[model samples]
Target chain A: MIEQSINKEPIIATDNNGIVIDIRGLYKSFGAHNDVLKGVNITVNKGENLVVLGKSGSGKSVTIKCVVGLVAADKGEIKVFGTDITELDDKQLNAIRIRIGFLFQNAALYDSMTVRQNLAFPLKRHSKSLSPKQEEDAIKEALDNVGLAEAIDKMPAELSGGMRKRIGLARTLILKPEIILYDEPTTGLDTITSREISELILAIQKKNKTSSIIITHDMACAKLTADRIVILKDGIIEAEGSYEELEKSDNDWVRSFFI
Target chain B: MVISLKNIFNDAGNVTQFTARFFKEVLKPPYEIKEFIRQCYVIGYRSLPLVGITGFIMGLVLTLQSRPTLAEFGAESWLPGMVALSLIREIAPVITALICAGKISSGIGAELGSMKVTEQIDAMEVSAIDPYKYLVITRILATTLMVPLLVVFADGVGVLGGYAGININSDVNLLNYFSKVLESLDFIDIIPATIKTFFFGFFIGMIGCYKGYTAASGTESVGKAANSAVVAASLTIFVIDMLAVQLTDIFF
Candidate 1:
């Protein structure tokens, strides 16, 4: 609900709260004809919760995909933690990826692996110093953090929608990423569960001091979770501000959601 | 005609992107070495029985069918060498590759395609896990290692089946038949044919993983990826085999 004047200029970079991600003039298209993302620019500060609100197929997902190098951009520079991700080779990108965590929309838990194994996966990959006992203790701590300590032995299929989300969060936290991305975290959950997840997301950001970019169509989620919201439409930024600033905008599309 | 041409061009473009992404991600580190071995077990070791049985039956049936033809030439003893050469140089590797294309390729395609449809892959990306290195490299490595082993086993069993046929139906001595078969076979025929299987495995693994990994939106796309994996892998195996034969003939 904090009001701040909107400006197109890049925010001044300071070392106190370092700029974690800087995306400049990003462009992506599936082919010669179908463009999914036009030139887009954004920056995320350390420990900030930035929500991306857009209609389905508005390139919100595509934008984040480019950030992680999941979907390569046709042009532009993406800098993460002062390193230019666009110029990074695969090895450098992977090194950056290990420091970032992502919570998939559908939880994306490996069906073949149990919750314990799922949590162990990233830890095993990213952590070399942890002994088997320490890995087990860490898994227990992560699962407990998400309040799913009891579901450690269970498969993803056995869990409810909300529980699966918790497991996904646990898997993401296992890596202790400096940045976390959430893609429609609450889209399919009921009202109560959705709010619970939002609170859980806030708790993680506070405790871990991790920056986040959440892509969702749920304005309620954007309002409750984001310090700043960026609304995308037709592959371009339509509006960018704090929740209260967007609510007060004269733009019909921005006002429609509020009214 | 124009519409069809346009469609082909569009498909080609998509394939190129998929290929580019695959190559880009594969060379990256944090390589899924353990997952790669597990997948090799699934795609290669688990698939061995089926490939072996099929090769055995193929050798048996082919030997039986060729007996009468060779009998007419009064050269029935040549049956052992002919069957042995064909099974080692052609049938075992091609058939094993095809079976793998059907089984491993389709399975990978369907599994990944469904993951895409359900947004699981997106979740991994958000979590900062490189799903490509985690998923594609493991599978491609599995196919690359396992296919050659499958081909080797299939070729050995197939020759035994041919020996079984000659021993049962004719007066050909089991020892003499095997000796003739072994004498006719050299490392050159076996090595080159087996070598081609690595490429076959690579193609099947790459095409299958590519189709599934880049599957379009929705549940139907999952089905399309699975189907396309099989079709693309089968076509690639045949094309590679033809090219290999032409090269081998010219060189040797």
Candidate 2:
């Protein structure tokens, strides 16, 4: 376990190893009794797909939310891009947030807006200098990347679950974020759609060269997309390895997940 | 019982803080002018028919009910001025504001509550957009500007309804009826009532946005937020009206 930095200075990795996200001794609690995350540590390297596997209420979602500053950690050091993000204010945090994309389980599309408007929302807010035609082209290109170019003008309510997830990905990718955190990218989809979304995750990592931490119960998605996997048990990481290595583990609890 | 009381205090503090943040963000740059206009169209223009109908009914009913009392006093001729004064100085503002609390506040609460439940608000936050500025401030500003205008519309429509009601018993020409109504109203009557409606608008928007923005994580909380927004906003309108009335009485 890495020690919490007392000075909150940016940690320079000696080897210049591509560790984009380094979390140390993260703690979070809800109310009095619910100690959701305890001394959790995680790191995501450049261009890596790290899948987080945990049972319900194990704080998998909270872990990524902490990374993005959506959920405040009780105590920890979250170093993203060598800077300790836990110490950053809202303005500073938003700067870091702009480089990271978070995909919610439900896709989180603005229902009041059409797909075209939804895609344009973040773009118009963040990139004010882009011309109208450039903004339109970006929206079109993003939708095209998700293979949903034809669904541009449709409202979010008009889309299927799989299509919504894809459009969610399109919106996430619109700003060309370096890292994407996906929370159960295939939770509610069927077998075929789940595979499609998983494949898209893989395709996005390849195409965009983006590092991602995907939280999921879908082992198939894990096997297809994860370069490494971490399993959470009792609020801390219990095991960490590649898919096949953990699949054959002697620990009955970890191996049970495979069966 | 103790916990529920504590919860009430907690909610009051939260709502106050939320309103403070609203004032802070509303003055900042990158103003959402476009969304503000859209919200005005939704909260103001869309609300006209219901407000108009309620105002007309309120005026007609007040006039009809008060007729017997005026007749008994042999002051039937004082009907137009009495109805006009009541409608302008108290009834129109309070009733119109209450209707808006029911309609606009609850609508905002439900819309924003749904957005919260679905994580669309979080999506906006992660996109480096301030959800409070974009969603809360815009809606609050729209309501603040629009509710006063609605009250004014209601006052006018109600006076016309009084004209209709007055013609039922005796022949009063439109010009003469309006002349009497106009003679009854003064700057004191109109200004204070209008000022109070602005407060009514602010509280309605503030309470609704507060409830929705701070809703707990669940599908059920959306319904809870919407329900509570109406109750809270309605209560607040009465409280503000009472205070406004007292202030008006003391000063004027």
Candidate 3:
């Protein structure tokens, strides 16, 4: 049996005006017979940190992917910053993507590029207004933001796992995106490093007022960074509330995460 | 048999989707120009020696083996032209393409397929980076440009190898053999064969990237992508080669 703690009413805060992302009735399937996501819906508000918690195969990543138009949904609607993502052509999708930042699990730093180039890539692609010197300055500023200014010349392979994640974060910050999606940011890091990343994420949210949707199974990370938590089960939202509200819920799956 | 047919159809459908996605993504802006150049170096320059050696040896062995047979008919003098024409029109390009299909296609397929399986591709997408253009276009461009150059190198080396074999084993002088080769081989023969190599390159790169890019499920899918890339590329090369030959005969 599925837990039913998800509130039917949309939770809206007065301070956050614009809806950064809105998903409704999203469905995706790898094959004809097996559906990965089934009628999933969530809305993320501007400047809010929304953490999606789920088991490994419950389609939390797929939901975020649909919002970004990375994975095409079989049937659904995804609106990012009020633009319908699914209806957009490639050029339009790309134009919209410039304002979004994503930090991947493995960093996905181009193995061929140095750390500075890795950080500079998004800036070079998205921001033509910045001159070469300005780009370099922005790259340095991003690296400094993640405490990685010293490792700019090193290749990703040379960096440790934590360093790679930080560099990835640095790359994400260069775009100064209003919406940042973090996938498993603390999955493999030690507690101290995880907490450090959590602090960095919180600091970023506070400084930039950037809304974020972080997908992770790490409850500690969710508790630390989430302004609101959403739990996904079987391709649907199972529970959504603040950490305290989720902790107090009578649902076994929600309680299991805390225990 | 019925189940196997169904699987084959499913695979064909997947390949079609992959091709469609590739077209869709290639039109998008923010191209990765630097990554394309780096891939060109890896796919083209790095694989040159291997292709060259194999092409040369094929020509040399073919000349050596055919020498006695032609000699029996008092046709030893035909060795140079025969070998050169064969190398230019068929052996060199096809062999080089096959070798590249095995090396480059499998490499691209395995590399990207593994990345897909490990969720690296998904990560790139989330990062607002077009993984298709970054990974696929760079690779496709590399193969398209490099395979033709590799074929050229292979053709030159193969002809020289044939000349060398003939000079060493028989009374044919190097100058005479090369002159015969030069007289017999025309631009007509060389151009079409070389042109078809571009198509060969495109198919090899496209199929490899497609199979790898859309690879699904677990770790086994990476291996499957690599395998399918080689298989698909090889089959496509032969089909294109046959068509090229037919078209060349019809027009020229």
**DockQ by candidate, in order:** 0.42, 0.89, 0.44
Write model 1 residue lDDT over A199-230, tens digit each, in one string: 99999999989999999877778788899999
lDDT of 1 by residue, B1-252 (tens): 999999899978977886677677776676777888899889987998899899898789889999999999998878989999999899889998999999999999999999888777766664446787788878987898899999889988898889777767767667887899988888888877988999998888989888899899889999999999999999999999999999888876
The CAPRI-style docking tier of model 1 reads acceptable
| Reference-based lDDT, each prediction | 0.84, 0.91, 0.84
1 or 3, greater by DockQ: 3
Model 3 chain A scores worst on lDDT over the 10 consecutive residues at: A1-10
Chain A (candidate 2) TM-score to true chain A: 0.94
Q: List the residue pairs that clash in candidate 2.
A: none
lDDT of 2 by residue, A1-259 (tens): 0012111223333212799889899999998999999999999999999999989999999999998888999998988887787898988788778788999999999999999999888887777667788888888888989899999999999999999999999999988888899999999999999999999999999998999999999999999999999999979999999999999998999998889
Q: For candidate 2, give the docking quality class from DockQ.
A: high
Q: Best by lDDT, which number?
A: 2
Residue A223, candidate 2: alpha-carbon lDDT: 94
- lDDT tens readout by residue for model 3, A1-259: 0001111122122222478888889989987777888898889999999999988999987787777777888998888877778987766776567667888777777776799877776666556556677777888888889998999899988999899999988887777777899989998999999999999999999998999999987788999999999999988889999999999999997879887
Off by over 4 Å in 1: A1-46, A69-96, A228-230, A233-253, B1-31, B116-134, B166-177
